[model samples]
Target: MKIAFVINQTHKEKAGFTTTLLAYSALQRGHSVYYIGLADFVYLDHDKIAAHARIIRQIGNIADTQQLIDALKSTSKERVFMDDFDVLWLRFDPVLDMINRPWAAAMGLQFAQLAQKLGVRVLNDPRALVDAENKLYLENFPEEIRPRTIVTRSYDDVKQFFEEQHHEIILKPLKGSGGKNVFLVNKQESKNLKQIVEVICRDGYLIAQEYLPKAQYGDIRFFLLNGKPLIRNGKYASVHRVQSTGEIRSNIHQGAKAQKAVISPEMLQMVEKVAEKLIQDGMYFVGLDIIDDKIMEINVFSPGALLQASELNGEDYAAAIIEDLEKSNGKNKTE
Candidate 1:
């Protein structure tokens, strides 16, 4: 199978990232893998979409993901046509480049959308991704499964929402990931509410959500592939992230520990509620941040921690994803 991962930058990826694991798994399976940076795309005169991709052909046994990362970094890039690949995985985070290279992610998605139109399968459907670019995407799901929230750049709106939620609310950048700029503001911190809103809104809009008391215990990072739980050997590919003491954000990169997730019937029910829409939207791979019954976020763009989940569950979740991709490619070929 020919698969190209569109990432923020080839040099910026880490061995621990889910993208690296998936790429390594594909290489281990003897498939062609390429890494395309967000700024590497080109549009030729004949409507051809190409990229100066970092190619990592399947070679001798790759010992680990670190080795793959080493090879990817050392290897020189070559122009590759996007349509020739079976899958063009959009794995770049928009917020990462929102400041300096604000045009990078948008241009990458535009190319991905064009590639999809030109018959190359694009994951997470770029058309839907345009709308799902921020926290507002969660509002598209059933209201019962989401926290009471308001998105605004107005300090008055945030202040009003905080007061409505009993002076307790979660403030975050509407388009951010990895818990950057996430804050748990309570009554005691009400004095700084305006400043917090101003900081978060500088990037774009800010999402002020009713603070879930259960968030004190952290949240679950649930993985879903093709709108269903990714499972292997009777274990689901999910992780329970426990934040450090006094911390409110449960993102793994934010001093949170990844433990084996305890999936409940209620969690599965929540999955069912959002499954149809996700499948319809072509969000082939997804991560949901759940706290109790309400989903704090839906991660469709570059969700991390699959490696941690696999390590905690003692399963090869990356292999499962690659195998699924192979099957999907085969099915598409037959169709």
Candidate 2:
């Protein structure tokens, strides 16, 4: 099977990214793999969508992730039609390019939606992704699992929410990621409330969430493939992220250390609660940021840390994911 991973940028993709893991795993399974950057997509005549993509074939038995990345970087890109691929995985993070290449991520999804219409299996459903362009998508799910949240662009609105919540809130950009603009505010330190709201709302709306007390202990990044936990040999493909001292964000890129996650029954039940809607919406893969019992965030586009999960759990999670993809592809072709 030919699988193409659409990422933010070819040069920016590290060897350790989940995209690289999946791409390398697919290649190891004797499948042709391709890497397409967000800005490389091209729409040709006859409604045919193509990309100036880096296509990798089994060349001299690539051994490691670095070897796979080196092989791709050494090769030049060619224009490959989107319909020629069996799977089109949109792995680009929208917020990564929200400032610099603001138009790039949206264009990538627009192309994915086109590829889906052309019968190429696109993961996470591009159509649903458009609706999930920001944090507000969480509101579509049962309110029970989500934190007390309010989206606003006005400083006064934020102040009201802060007071209502007794002056403890987690302030962040509604359209941001990687903990770039996240801040924690309390009643005593209200001096920065106006400034924080102003800074966060500069780009878009501000998400003022009632501060979850468990956040200090960090959060668990639990991955769901096809709306269920991605597991192998009774080991879940999930990781517990513990934040470094003096940090509120537990993102790996933000210096958080990854460890094994203890998946509680309550967490599984929470997954079950949202699984149906996710499946119906064609969300084939997602990462739920579970802090205690409440979900902090839902990452549908470009969820990472799979390698960490495998390393911590001692399971070949990438192989399992590839196997599932193959099975789903075969099932789809027959139906």
Candidate 3:
């Protein structure tokens, strides 16, 4: 099958990371692995999509990992119709980019939607990504599993939320990802409350949630593909991200270290309950931020943790992910 990976620059990604391994595994399986980034696509007014893709030339004999990497690196990219590919993997990590062009992020989804329309399977459907962009998207989970939450920018509303929740609050930017500027506030720090709320609220809405104190230990991340738990043997594809000393946020970007996690029944239940809806929403894959027994975040757009999970479980998740994509494409089954 002709598979195209929409990703960040090659060589820059850490070796053994899931994205790299997936592409490597795909190439090893003799699938035509085309690596395209955000800069590669060409969306047209004719309701058609195209991309100048880095289509890999198959190597006759096997060599080393570097040889395989160099082989795909040597592609002479040319414009091609999106309809030509059997799969268009939207693998770019939009949230981590340095965007001079904000429209580029939105455009990737636009093109992915078009690719799906053209009969190419686009992972983690474009529409779900748009909704997931909002931090309030976490509210879509079962209310019992969530803390007292309010999505509002109004200062009065936030203040009232603080009062209602007894200032047991965690504040965050609704538009932000990877735990940047997520503040855990108590009534004693009321001095900084207004300023923090104002700054985050300026972006869009503020996610004023009752702080889940269980977060002090760490957070667990569960990777789900095609709305099912992506497990290997008996171990699950998951990690317990213990935050580096003094850090409140356990995001890998925020210096969290990945350790093995036992996926508890509660965690599985949460993922199961949310899976069908996520799959229905074009959410081909996602990582759930399990803080305590509750989900703090649903990372749909370019969810990480596969590499961490791989390390923790000593299994090849990147290969598993690529294999799943292959199966999804091969079977062409419906939800």
Candidate 4:
């Protein structure tokens, strides 16, 4: 299988990232793997989609993800046609480029959509990704699993939601990740409410959600593939991230510690609630952030933590994902 991973940038990727693991796993399986940055794509005349991709060469000699990262950085990018790839995996964080290269993520998606139309499999369906680009996408799911939330660029709207939620609310960029600019506000600390809203809205809109008290204990980062729990050897691919002292964000990169997740019946039920829509949207891979009984976020674009989940659960989730893709593509060919 020839798979191309579209990421924010090759230089910005780390060895511990889920994208690295997937690419390394594909290489270990003797499949061709390529890394494409958001700005790497080129559109030729006659509707051909191509990219100057960093091809992971000599996969046999590369030992692990660090080596893969090194190769990706050291190797010069070579032009490759997108249609030649068996899978064009959109693994980039849209918010990463939203500031400096506002056009990068959208252009990447546009190229992915073109690639999909040309019969190349694109994961997480580009069309769906367009609408799912921001936190508002969570509204598309059943309200039962989501927290009381409001999206606005107005400080007054945020203030209203804060008052409605009894002066406790979580505010963050409507389109963001990695816990950047996330703020937890309460009645006693409402002094900075207006300022926070102003800062967050500078980029775009801000999401104000009823603060779940359970968030003090951190949240679960659960992995789902094809809208189902990614399980291996009776263990689900998930990690319970414990936030640092006095911190509200449980993002792994935001000083959160990863531990084995204790999957509950209620969590599985929540999965069932969102699974159908995810499958229908062609979100082949996703990550859900759960606090208590409500889902705080649905990460369709580059839902990470698979590596940490694998380490904690003693599972090979990357291999499982690659194997599933291989089988699915094989079945498609046979059909």
TM-scores for all predictions: 0.97, 0.97, 0.88, 0.97
Instruction: Point out where model 1 deviates above 4 Å.
Output: 331-335
Between candidates 1 and 3, name the one with more favorable TM-score.
1
Candidate 4 residue 299 C-alpha distance from true site, Å: 0.6
Model 4 segments more than 4 A misplaced:
331-335
lDDT of 1 by residue, 1-335 (tens): 88899999988999999999999888878888899999899999456889999987774656998888998999999999888888899999999899999999889889998898789999879999999998899999999999999988999888888888998999999889878999989989989988888888788888889999999998998999999999999898999999999889888888998888899998999889999999999999999999999998999998889999999989999999998998877833111
Per-residue lDDT tens digits for candidate 4, residues 21-108, read: 9989888877878999998999895468899998864486788899889888999999998888889999999998888899999999
Which has the higher lDDT value, candidate number 3 or candidate number 4? 4
lDDT of 2 by residue, 132-230 (tens): 989888889999999999999989999999999988999999988889989999977699899888889889898989998889999999999889999
Which structure is stronger by lDDT: 2 or 3? 2
Q: Evaluate all candidate structures by whole-model CA lDDT and list the values in order.
A: 0.90, 0.89, 0.76, 0.90
Better of 2 and 4 by lDDT: 4
Per-candidate alpha-carbon RMSD to the true structure: 1.9, 2.0, 3.4, 1.9
Cα error, candidate 4, residue 243 (Å): 0.4
Please identify model 2 stretches exceeding 4 Å from their true place: 331-335
Q: What lDDT is reached at residue 167 by model 2?
A: 85
Best by lDDT: 4
Error of 3 at 241 (Å): 0.2
C-alpha displacement of 20 in model 4, angstroms?
0.3
- Name model 3 segments beyond 4 Å from true: 8-12, 44-48, 57-76, 97-99, 331-335
